[model samples]
Target: MPCRDLPPPPPPAHLRGWLDEAVVRADRARFLSDLGRRSLGVGRLLLLWAVAAVFVLGWSFIGMAWMAFEQHDPFGYVYGLILAVLGAGVLIPAGFWVARGARRDRQVRHLLHAWGESDRDPVADARVRAPGRSLTWLVTSLVLGAFGLWVAFAAAVSARPGDTTYGEVAYTMGIGQILWITGLLGLAKAAAHYRWAVRTFRAPAP
Candidate 1:
């Protein structure tokens, strides 16, 4: 058999470097876009869960109240009524906000899809940070934490040995702890965002 000549060597290092960088940028952009989409999906699911909880728990309380009324049990009626009222108070606004957020997330996802196709710099744009968004979350966490603390205090004051309010008191304390932990997490997130923004802003221009 006749011997065949070998093919020429590969492209130069500089050209290969450029190709590698291009591929990396493309991958990064896709990753950021996918992350944004997943985050939005999770947010929507959480909102839906909240809505379901509000309705289901609220209706359950109201049903209990109705049964108590039929039995002429004043304490049970009042307890259920109070819980039903609290549930109702949280439900209406949460339902509306979830609806709006779902619609907005859908629109943003559409925009993200379009941008990912056309923009080479999609990673930067896909960050999706509002100027004061972190601050807003921090403030909300503070308010919730404070409210939870107050509730816990009240529960502690009302708690007694072999009392009917023991379960309520324990529940309130648990809620307070959860709220405090949530607030701390929010604070940490806000601080991280602040540090990142500062670093990015102060860095020298490329």
Candidate 2:
């Protein structure tokens, strides 16, 4: 007589438990990795902005330096006139650029916090390490940007070649300074948010 085939056996008890735990960890890991990407994304954007700010500041500096070598007061009068036009046009726009980056960084910080505040808290197991590198860049930007602004102010008010020259150099300097500050502020805000995320996640659960 043909015997009926035995039913397939259930998985071993210990193996089943271990498998479930592994699955949980794996799922959490994937989720945390995504979150980390988001956290770092803001930093990357700030970095791009920082580059642009530096470029503008550098180019303006080059223009200011040219005036020093020419030493032709009339040429300076023309330079001052050109700078006044650019100061109002370009410098004003740079302020908005900074505000834009800061706004984006602010929104990102909120998103980072919301991730852990979810009702289920399934991804709490993910750990965040100290963001020393990000912090360094941020602080550097702040200090440098501030110094740049001061330099611009000094240049603008400095003795000019003619009556109309006014503070042409100073105006140009101010624009460069503002550009740097905006980048710095954006980076600093992002670093602060990242630090908070890491600390909050690592803290003992309520």
Candidate 3:
């Protein structure tokens, strides 16, 4: 008689159920892991933006102070100096905070990547957490951008060529430009995060 071939048997019932459960758990873990990674990425971007804002604003104020002093405008010089001091105050603390956060983020990212590659469950891991909706960030960005635009427009409208030097106009415009650009970028990031969250974390139907 010719040799007969038989199909392999399916998994045992209990084993099949357990296997399906494992798959579900693993899928959830991977989702959480990816979410955590994205959150960290946003955080890093915000931190970088903070550094840039501090650097640009601080220098802008200092440059304005110098220009105003050269022009012998007492009010402008004093105003500029006050702003410069305020900028320095913010920059000092922000610098340290950003550096620490950057280091921590790098460490967390490494851990999450390793956990994912190893098929470890990120849900069980406390380090993995979901990000917020980012509404606050979005609103703040819009407000700052609006305020900057208003300031820039007002400065441009009020200053006459005879009364204002090129340096004065340039410095005044620079502050507003920096603020609006930073705010616009922040708004984009916040909106992106919000959209991602909405898409990824849809509510389950009752």
Candidate 4:
């Protein structure tokens, strides 16, 4: 037997607005996370490119300097070019400049997922500020890398001056030095990045 007339069932409430809001939020979070990841990747690549560039430049400088010592040739146009311009002007400044930037922009994003929101990151309060970790690596690594380049360049330059092939030799040596210096510097940066990454993104203890 059916009980007759309770009132008709309440009309169903609409949920489209709530659903849309949730979807939008999730999409924004994903986008931010992606950007954060991309920024990290780009920074890393730049650091490496800068390093390689330095090494190549250093190698060239070394070759030129070595030619200075060689007696096979006199101070030719080659000597003036390297000593005057590319070595002093380009590679040296480039090395220091890149290193400076690397040191400056190091940071750990506490929650990349909240990139879209004003203040919705789940762990917004848990951000751990990392200081000096990157700078330490940058300074130490850049110095070593730069020094290595200088040594390589100096070696080539100290070769007997006036070697007939001094021009060619010097050019080769300088280019090699620059490339090597850059590589070494880049390696140091990579190592530092790895270290920082390890620290910043350390897995939570169980």
Candidate 5:
């Protein structure tokens, strides 16, 4: 007899529904895994940007303090020192907080990847279904918003005629704008997380 290609046996009818359900679950796990990866990347980038901003702006504040002291201006020195201290207090902790978040995200991504690889693993399935929240994002948003408010206040106080240099006014306003924008970005990320959680983990109504 000539060599022939044998037709594959069909799955039993009773098992079809179960197979389909398994496939659906696997697909959902894959989707969540991909979302987690993308979110991780975005979170890391935003956090790194915040850290960079902290160092740059923090140094600028110190430089301003030195200039004020050299110019024999008590008010200027006080203002600069206050801002420098505030920036150090807030931004340093914020940086570390964000860094910790990035590490957690990394671990979550790894777990998600492993879950994707072994779609039938019950442990992986449970891990995938667990809800998570990022405290770092929340804290960072609040911190940045607070800093923005302080900068705005400084700008207003420094705007009095003949009381401040043009550079000082411009710098304060510019930093304020940047801080507000970054803060809004953090809020946006938090909103994204909320939406994802609601969509993915919400219980179905009867």
Candidate 6:
């Protein structure tokens, strides 16, 4: 619980006909702190996912480029090169963006805590933040995950017959990895939000 003490100087005056400034400041700080923490967590996970995607997808394109040269397909090789460059190019800016956002969120959390009152009402926050319905997203994630699994299985099984080259295997496996990662991330987020929604909306015990 936050102390009801009025910390320091008075709040700004646009109009003095409003409620207590300290209470308003405390409430806003608590809400922003909560929001910052949640965003920070998601941002970290997203950064990891982004790095993983760059590697998986970038390697797959490299493999395609190699295969294209071996097959003497100029267009395919060029296309692969372009995609590989684009995919890898994004990582530099993406790294900077995530890092900057994470830093800002951390600063917000720290500042809010120092400004007196950081405790948040989870149930009330959930009512505002949680989705109304996430079932559709959940189902979509499941389908994507299943498809990714099938893709990976097919790629792995093809090696047993020695019919497909290593490059082909790498390309397909990379695609599968991308899809699998996306699906798992989506499912996790959607399920968590749905759970929060249920918990927040449930009737109070008698």
- Which is the leading candidate under lDDT? 3
How should the candidates be ordered by lDDT, best one leading?
A: 3, 5, 6, 2, 1, 4
lDDT of each: 0.51, 0.53, 0.59, 0.49, 0.58, 0.57
Give lDDT tens digits, candidate 5, residues 84-198: 6865776577668767756655555444443344334454444443334345666777788778868967797768777776556666766776676667766676666555444
Cα lDDT of model 4 by residue, 1-206, tens digit: 01231122111236434556565455544544443433344455455656566656654565565556453455654574566465666567766866665543342232332232232434321221122434544555576567757765765776675553766655755555554555565556556445544554555579
Q: What is the lDDT of residue 46 in candidate 4?
A: 59
Q: Which pairs in model 2 have colliding backbones?
A: 155-170, 156-170
**Alpha-carbon deviation at 206 in model 6, angstroms:** 3.2
TM-score of each: 0.42, 0.49, 0.49, 0.40, 0.48, 0.51
Candidate 6, residues 14-59, lDDT tens digits: the string is: 5424867567655654554354334334444455456556656566
Give a tens-digit lDDT track for model 3, residues 1-206: 10232122233446656667676456546555554645434554566466657856665766566676666777877876787687677667766876765565444444444433433343444434344435556776788788778777877887897787766776777778767876786687567555544443444459
Model 6's number of clashes is 0
Residue 120, candidate 5: C-alpha displacement in angstroms: 14
Candidate 1 segments exceeding 4 Å error: 1-16, 20-30, 33-129, 160-165
| Lowest lDDT 10-residue stretch of candidate 6 | 1-10
lDDT of 2 by residue, 32-92 (tens): 4444444454456456556566557645654564554356687776775665466456656
> Candidate 5: where are CA atoms >4 Å away?
1-24, 40-132
Clashes of each: 0, 2, 0, 49, 0, 0
Can you list the residue pairs that collide in candidate 3?
none
What local lDDT score does residue 159 receive in model 6, on the 0 to 100 scale?
A: 77
Task: Give lDDT for model 6.
Answer: 0.57
- Model 6 stretches with alpha carbons more than 4 Å out: 1-60, 68-87, 91-132, 160-162
**Greater-lDDT candidate between 3 and 4:** 3
